[model samples]
Target: MRHTWLICGLAICLSWGTSVRAEVTITPDVVYGHKSGLAMTMDVFTPTENVNGAGVLFMVSGGWYSRWQPPEQMQDRFKPLTDKGFTVFAVRHGSSPKFSIPEAVSDVRRSVRFIRKNSDRFQIDPQRLGVYGYSAGGHLSLMLGTASDDGDPAAKDPVDRVSNRVAAVVAFVAPTDLRIMVKDAPDRLDAYARFPALDLDLKAAEADSPLVHVTPDDPPTLLIAGDKDDLVPIEHSRNIQAAFEQADVTSRLIEVAGAGHGFRGEDARRSTASMVEWFQSQLAP
Candidate 1:
């Protein structure tokens, strides 16, 4: 995949004695892989003052190929964190057919390394990094939390040495086990099986599972899921919470009664509030 990084040349000319305005840098569509030819991108939001010591957030969205752009609601969704002195990074990763879940996971790891390498320039405290994602994105956040530290010491890039481990993770309706997700996907199971491009080999699916990678050292995790979620079984979080308990890792789960795959009405508001609270408690100095 060949991707062009288009910085939307919005020029700024500050007058004498004027304050500098906040700016966002979008490294649009950079190819991270050569085989699947997959690429990813980021839209980074920075605070105008004292961002150097602030927390960092990498926000990824759910989409197997659709809904690649950030939802309009997310702007306000992110404001609270940024206002509280955080730098938010909205990332885009390749999804399905064009690439598999494993490939997408690798892309995310690469994106984290890229961000940490440039953290000083972005005024980010690399140690205070966090990840927040919804649906498929949620699963990716878990992967980053659990399986990110497998290092390649011989890698040429110095950024590769920076650990991909996050300080915390905020997840919504994340699928922990692919095998269970495949078995439980009511209407979409057949469609997914028929789609050869999905390339879901049993072994590969298990290998890509976030639940399979949990350890005692894993970071604190907050999971929010609807009890009636059809796409992601409620057992996904239940089992993960169970594992966390066994490992003595800090974890919490909030199941919204009667809520479906995604939250609705007040459910959405409460869920977001819980997530905000969790991140604040864990990521704040």
Candidate 2:
């Protein structure tokens, strides 16, 4: 079954087990501390029956597009797990330009906290959380999975106590290394302003990059990218996998032959299937 939140354009696709139906709540934009605000909200797909405690937290792409429409393909992409009994939370966050990457990253982090903080009401297993995304969304998912605990400890809200860490991450066509990404991707740089202009020095780059943060403690990651991707270069994902290897963490890089950044047509569908399988194997209870 497919669950959707109209205002936020969040969509959760349930496949393996029945999706719990719940009304989508639109919480007003509130700030996390003094920095990140609640311009973002989440759609919880609760199974109608007493929830069996299965679920995944998802973030959709928010690049340069005028509207942040959750791709229909994503719903189809995640159906495999949903069919098997995982409730999915399709999360929506404020995008670039209006907000900086740090701000957006904080918003994504806040969304995870929101879901876990209210996991009981949503009937989801907080500890069983997994995350997935595409393009910029994929980048955001990686941020949540990688930068889970980097938040400030001085935050006052009780929800700030919630951990944003995810058990697994599936990122499609994400630029793992922002330094190389800015050097090689002018188009994407134009899409998300400030990011490319930010410090690209070694120290700053490492701090801003997911690959640099990779440690054995990080959750297993599945990186999918087109070998011929012109926009974000497949090397970006390759570099990230290498970092994972150096850290002795589990990482898999699936290169779709002759495919571009977005993996159009049949390739897109196939990429989505691979992501579903990865999530199922890593996240299923």
Candidate 3:
């Protein structure tokens, strides 16, 4: 749609000492979408030095809950990508207990479209965009990768005319198959308690699940999961890998030994490195 974006002046910050430093510019609270009269915003991090001409969208979600973290607070999580010359867009979606999963997904999709539609302003290639997320965010990343669509040319809104597809995706500890997840642990259904108004429709669940949308045209995906994860079983990644194989799509599954749902210490560092490498390889210009 032809929505309005309130982009503020760039705030520049230096990383490290003068000898080896990176000039990073951050623009916070750029409106991308609105629901219930509330604006959905994102923080855009652009490396003023050594520009890569590519962007990676990061979903800040855990347990289906999303909160906006300032650029300074997320420096550790995004420094790896920024150091590698990749622009980062940290997107925040509507949280649960007030919004449903479907609504959150829609907000993310709209954010992608907004970025693509205004890629020139960001000084990056629209087609070279990639996505990354952990836990519930990872699930949404896969959803975007598998279920993206080209915008309608007939739509009057220019943003709606842009495509939502990405070149690559990195999802960590995501639930690819919701049906299987609920079957394994019925109690997990409690996560969806916020959406009690919806009917119990199996077809809706199948349609919403990322596993059912895999196709050859889907973006190359890297699924990372900890073998010791009890919250989201490792089998979820395995099943997603199998689905990718069946669809003849490019996909990889990484199982971290002795790691749980949340990787820590060396494991966390390794996961971060792996994601940065994957994005560099897939989204590099």
Candidate 4:
């Protein structure tokens, strides 16, 4: 009954059907960029059937720390999207302690540009790309969805010339405004002490916070969070959702009653379906 919950909240033991129904060509460790002489990587999963020419990026981050697992082993975990004809990319960024939040955000932005540049090869519309992740991964997802770039046409690198904007996003239980994360806590957070990425000056935190960047041009986003989540908290999602509405951006917030940072049983099923439907509606031509 344990399924690998892949996203920013860590590897959560949960319940989900693990039967791999969709066939896909699994390409692992595709280099998206290089940082400090190390290659940033993403695994590409292309469906063998029902090719929809749309791509979905799953941010492989938790607590600003990224991790990787072989793509072959995650077929079932990706089946919900792949079955919907989505080309899924499991994108990993520089981890915390070694790399900070600003660096992680920069890495994924480059990854988006990289993917958009190679859209023809990947056979997905550069414009139809979407993103998904939970918790810390969700934070990155919102960052991508909110603070996107038009790409410098005069940039030296061709990939950097492609826009980093996405078509849609599914940010689950993400901390929207990092600036308040430390101060609003009921007590001192041990996480801030342990995770260097969580500890930031107001300026740096504001610069990295997605809530600081919501705009009218932001792509439609569907946020799913548990009302009972205490780790990242539900207020994070609520605040961002409220901002989205005020900005007149197309958005939806699905609060899973009695759920937490991670979903299970019927909660997981509903959240997964919500993500799929959002993408289907938003990514379509």
lDDT of each: 0.67, 0.63, 0.78, 0.84
Query: CA lDDT of 48 in candidate 2?
Result: 42
lDDT of 2 by residue, 232-273 (tens): 678888888888888887889999999776666788777777
The lowest-lDDT stretch of 10 consecutive residues in candidate 2 is 1-10
Model 4, position 102: C-alpha lDDT score: 91
Give the TM-scores of the predictions, in the order they appear. 0.80, 0.76, 0.87, 0.90
Please give the TM-score that candidate 4 achieves against the real structure.
Answer: 0.90
Best by TM-score: 4
Candidate 2 regions with alpha-carbon error over 4 angstroms: 1-38, 47-52, 64-78, 150-154, 183-206
Estimate the lDDT of model 1.
0.67
User: Candidate 3, residues 75-191: lDDT per residue as tens digits?
Assistant: 666889998889899998887647766777888888999999889888899999999898778888999999989988899878888899989999998878766443333556453
The residue pairs in collision within model 1 are 1-37
Q: What TM-score number comes out for model 2?
A: 0.76
Of 2 and 4, the candidate ahead on TM-score is 4
Q: What would the per-residue lDDT of candidate 4 be over residues 37-132, giving only the tens digit for each residue? A: 888888878888988899999998877888777566766777899999999999999998799899999999999999999988889999999999
- In lDDT terms, which candidate is top? 4
Question: Per-residue lDDT for 81 in model 3?
Answer: 93
Error of 2 at 248 (Å): 1.5
How many backbone clashes can be found in candidate 1? 1
lDDT of 2 at 137: 68
